[model samples]
Target: MSSTQLRANDPQIPSSADGSQGLPLLVLGALGVVYGDIGTSPLYAFREALHAAGSPSVSFARLEVLGLLSLIVWALTMVVTIKYVSFVLKADNKGEGGTLSLTALARESFRGRPVWILVLGVIGASLFIGDAIITPAISVLSAVEGLEVVAPTLAEWVVTITVAIILALFLVQRFGTERVASIFGPITALWFLALGVSGLVHIVEQPSVLAAVNPYYGVRFLVVHAEIAIPVLGAVFLAVTGAEALYVDLGHFGRKPIVVAWFAIVFPCLLLNYFGQGAYVLTNPVSEHPFFEMQADWTQLPMVILATAATVIASQAVISGAYSLIRQAMHLNLLPRFHVRHTSETQSGQIYMPQINTLLLICVVVLIISFRSSSALSAAYGIAVTGEMLITAALLFVVMRRIWQWSLLFALLVIIPLAIIDVGFFVANVAKFAHGGWVPVVIALSAAFLMQTWMAGRRLLISKTRADEIPLRTVIESLTKKQPLTVPGTAVFLTSDVEGAPTALLHSLKHYKVLHEKNVILSVVTSSSPFVADNDKIFYESFTPHFSRVIITFGYMETPNVPRALVLAKKLGWKFDIMSTSFFLSRRTLIPAAKGGMPFWQDRIFVALAQNASSATDYFRLPTGRVVELGIQTTI
Candidate 1:
């Protein structure tokens, strides 16, 4: 299909054709994708920060406890509310929000902005991807670790179960998660309710702990012993780690729904839990289950099960996010061409990419075997999150100047505080470099290398092939002496553009110089976000003087249903039943062609990505028997 048509703002969104149910599903599903990581952060944030402060006795009299709460609330206000909600949410490009999206905006607008800024933005986004890998690992382990409390001896068993659960989730991705997603929102909603309930019970028991919210406690705690505070701040920032996920995933749910959901349910529950954890710690001298200690002993099983399910759901959200990010990478020419399978027909946001799933599964397993506990993963988590925050800061600067036309003073006021706070987390996490942070660094480095290589290779391929990409009009005038003969059926060419490629037409002529049985239809398929509109459809009346051309677009949310698209195209005038007509693809297999143009290294990389790209038949969803391949050699 066409890419231009699927933009989220397309009128197709509220169309009578889609029915009224799609919007609500999209709103909830988007919330899951966006909040999964942040939602699960509560599992360790307060606990780790508390544990780091020398496991201070649970009491309102203890200044460390009050300081910890103050740090938690302020960090959330700065990193999550101020930076992400107020600033990053406004830094969007066509409803698409991400580090890369921001980078593009910056590069396009502030072309000469300091090179270091761009570098930081890339590093940030790349690291976020790495964080994505570890999120699944740590979140799952944190939840399943509960088994130890259930049966201390079952710790090993818990690991096995956690691994198995993760494996099953990845394996079933190809089958699609549309049906499962229908309930994810409701289930996640319930999980938040449980967390709130647990927090409420503690709040009622010890009302005085609420005083920790006062800013004075945080200030005194930090200055009293700033040395220890440095490391403690490391854990404090963890509370707000996934805050950016909310901004990046804004496209999934419109701003209104996400804002509504956050204020109505998500935000309150999170605060209560943070306060509740503080209350529980303040009351209990010995908390075997600091979190479960916040709840009654009889309620253990329910919390355990809810926590387990919630964590798994959270991990799954990152897994899906990795898939979506990679898909976007492919579209933007920063990744090798991989098979992208549409997991849902009705819900465009649902997608399953195999390469990404396998990577997540492998990395998560490795993370568990190496770090072994939620505490260890803690060292790895903040680095990626912090790095991503810096990248988002740079991106927001661009959006302010370019899109919003805000003055530099205004932009700096918004971004500087973010840089300061995130820089602290970054430095603290650097101390953890040798601990468990290496995994995320390794993943980020790998992703960055892959992206650079793919981009370098594409630049070479596109540049080399530019001269050879024969104009469509030129192809028709030079080759076709008579008008294209109309026949019993339409013959569609899998064209790169609706018009172009003398080689394609020449091949068509070489195979059958004169049309004998089918009308010629040149079709161009475009890429757009999974959930967008379709409006740029066009049928050319005069191209190459002999052949007719047509363009069709598909939202990334929609699968390349060739037959379905053909039916729609036919209704618009080009008649071809995909089930009967053959689909053709031009594949260039690069051999070390010594020296037409591209750099030597580029030639090799091109060969690599070309070799790695999905087979056209499967990528295009063509019936194997009915598909045809044209092995064409490019000058490069």
Candidate 2:
């Protein structure tokens, strides 16, 4: 598919208004949240860069420092700014972005083996869940690690205060972050600009330090200090940790604005400050300024406050990103379904998932106690970041071939370099497994299991229902007729797909044993895309069996709200109010049954997820008072 053909087909593809205006906020939020992994790298990026040599005592040459700064700058420019921002963000699913949305795209284009694409998609999405598990722990723990720097004696209370804050963060999550969210962009923007301003002061003071960008600093450091540099990559990689988060958040910001913010604001500021830190260290090697040390005495308190604000914003982004990821996971069959509340009345992007919040809160508390310092948490961060990156690269390859239709030569040229960087990061991060990095790997693995089990369980349930299912045509022919059993009202059973067995329809007919004279529509909600068009949504067919089936389509980005949909579809069908209609919902209960049975472990997994899964009544936004539930038992 050429870009022109893709656009021609997808007139709803995000335009400049969406990418430029909406994306910055989303990008900022993601940067704020995801950056917690790396934004704090300045605490270590340069300090560790110098330690790339055998000791911190080496004579700091101007060239070495400049080269390191350039590496940081170019890495951000090439990786974050160019590779993802300029390209990847364009790959949206009906103007939404997430791993599964990309998966949906690949599914539509590949049109071949779906299981392989699903495997890759699930791995990538699950890795983010792993990050959701670790980010709060590492992020808050890292920030509170600052107490030791700002005041060493307060270090004893770091764990206590950090845990308190994380607990409180989750506790208040239900109230929503609208008031706080508005300021996320401005605060982060200031943090970057302030960093730049502070760096410029130091850079002018030691102009010679700018030469470190000459490549020799990074190159020579690797050559002369291979032993030390081996471990240092772990820390340097942290500088770009938020880089992937920016791409993950593409749905919020349309890629263009995030790209602008990165190039015009974020990139320059981060580089200037990093080099400024290098400059500060070059001139006064003995100075102990983790971040605020570079500031003048009068400015230290404000800087501390600003840094804290920025850190919180960064953490907030991760927290919110967690909610967003969990929602996507539920929709895509990667996780057990859960209650997801749209928190922001105005912005659909603002969402809340209680299950994830509690989980994150617990993990953060544990991290604060176990690690007690950012250094310990650093080990666990790499695998989640790079593993997801590799998954993204793999998906990107599929996108280029099937959707973008880029030539094999071009795809290989791009993939080889990304693979090298991605694999190196994965291998290096593995060295930290003993330290605490195993935690995220464990989390990601568990998340993947939960998701896979739910999907497997659901598939099994549907298959069993089909086996027992009386075909609609047969049922209608035998039972449905113009007779004394004519019911005064209509009963509509909602389904996800048309062909499969509908337990709801079976339950409705079994219990009621009547047909309405006016209108009784068998509605199936389809994910609207290339398969179906929005205008041609209200299609119906009256099989000779007296059953009129209606299939309605909605885009991926559109959250299904049944009542609103009914109203939109009113013109074509019976008036919702006058129809005297009642909606029938059939809920599934997971239990261990030898009939249609899954493995024992899988059974337990489904039961667990089913227990946690959100009620369908709430998810559909159907008039709660009017919904009648028919519970169907299934052995997973």
Candidate 3:
């Protein structure tokens, strides 16, 4: 079996294939892609936390600064380092890790498909999409807002400049990021180095700022300020918003590289920066933008420029992640198929989706223009991140108990506190609903609703079609007794149901009154795992002298290329020729029913989604000229 096909519980599976020689390079790559979100947090996390504790105009006491800093420090340590790096990373499905990957792993522990687990996975994925849309808007806005500090005269142009940069970023996504991606590591490394050095200088000025490292300060602040704790927790969560990338990008760069980068470089630098900001705030108590103000006047403009670049890289990581997540959703049958364009010849993971990119661009631009400031958008950000984190914690418990075979007591002991922390953050963010938190909530809910509708609608359509479909065995028996005029070439009928006669095949017989010399019933099956082994890709069975069944299995993380997979049939004793073959597909035209399966609104939504979905020819990477689509109008 391929390494990717191994179960999560297998002890022999290696965490990564990159050996010792490649470790350093992998670490560099992790810095750019994995840590982009959290690395840029210093720009506004501390400031937002401070604003939440008291008025921005108020000069907080030394204790308040230390307390807030303490909370930020431990939040990173507990949430990112412990929960993700040490624990969640071990629950990877085969060698891949993400919300959906974990969901697949957990579902595999059961005897049959479980509805609750599927719902959790859908919700987790939906919340992540919400995060993807908001990250670019807020990260770039925060970085560009530094212009207000640079000139104060450019404050009016901040939104305009931000929108222009965002527009340019989305426009270039079509060309692929392979070339520009090389510089991401170096640029991000320099950004982190700057963060450490600036903070170290301030720490030297007042060594006392390091006191925030103790948990006592963080605890004391929460106890004393209980009334404001919810808002404060929500704001502090901004510090670890991008922590999910650690587990999400595990397949790209291994666990070791991400952990090493976080502990050795990313973590220390973030600490220095947060401490430096706190120390700077102590001396210059009224500083509103301490991140830019902490730097010397000569370096402030350069800092702003570098910060903008870092934020762009952060946006890129999340945007790319969004593409990967949506692809997984499509393969798992949770969504209608979208046109997926592979941007790199060698790397299957490098993909670009035009429809997704355009939608993201529109939503992001609307957000930037409507909010007009990073602080305002921050109100809408924490809800999605916290909601996703909570879902991960819930799924982790199931994996521990069932997949790993851990004792129930042991699993509960490990997961409960972590879940509680997640709940705290989630509840805190929920408090911001009227204040703008409703944005991500609305986005996530809408995405989840669409996914449910698609899945439900497909189920109904399948059931309805199956009821009308003739049994393939019966059809083959009838053909044996009375054969029609045989055509010379092969005809492959594509279907979702392997046992039922394909609608196209049945229609062909009724209309043309002819049969091909060879007929193959082809069905594509998506595996629960991320990638399937080539050895296990094709399943073939011959029903009669002229009829056979071919099932091609693809992993949820893969793009289904029917023509390429069909080539594997040669190994199963079937001669496959793309040039001489004709592919038949049943094109569905869905009409909403007056009563039954779904509500009127959802039925309408499902029909719209079906209409907009990419054609099977494009989605399956089949040859366009050899394909014949037969339209079948159906109601549900």
Model 3 bad stretches (over 4 Å): 1-21
- Return the top candidate by lDDT: 3
Q: Pairing residues by index, what is the TM-score of model 1?
A: 0.86
- Candidate 3 lowest-lDDT run of ten: 1-10
**Order of candidate numbers by lDDT, starting with the best:** 3, 1, 2
Candidate 2 Cα deviation (angstroms), residue 276: 0.9
Residue-wise C-alpha lDDT for candidate 2, range 438-516, written one tens digit per residue: 8888888877777787888778777776777766555555554433366666667766546643578667656876656
Q: How far is candidate 1 from the true structure (C-alpha RMSD, Å)?
A: 4.7
> What RMSD does each model have against the real structure?
4.7, 4.9, 3.7
Query: Model 2: which ten-residue window has the lowest total lDDT?
Result: 1-10
Question: Per-residue alpha-carbon lDDT of model 1 for 478-595, expressed as tens digits?
Answer: 5455555444544556765444563555576677665525534555453433333544433334343234555556544344555544454544444556666766566776674677
Query: Model 1 residue 155 lDDT?
Result: 72
Q: lDDT, candidate 3, residue 362?
A: 98
- What would the TM-score be for candidate 3 when compared with the true structure? 0.96
Global lDDT of each candidate = 0.69, 0.67, 0.91
Q: What shift in Å separates residue 130 of candidate 3 from its native position after superposition? A: 0.9
Clash number by candidate, in order:
15, 14, 0
Which candidate, 1 or 2, has the higher lDDT?
1
How far residue 499's Cα lies from its native spot in candidate 1, in Å, is 7.4
Give me the runs in candidate 1 sitting further than 4 Å from their true place: 1-33, 55-61, 100-125, 285-289, 467-472, 481-490, 495-502, 508-533, 537-541, 551-581, 592-606, 621-626, 633-636
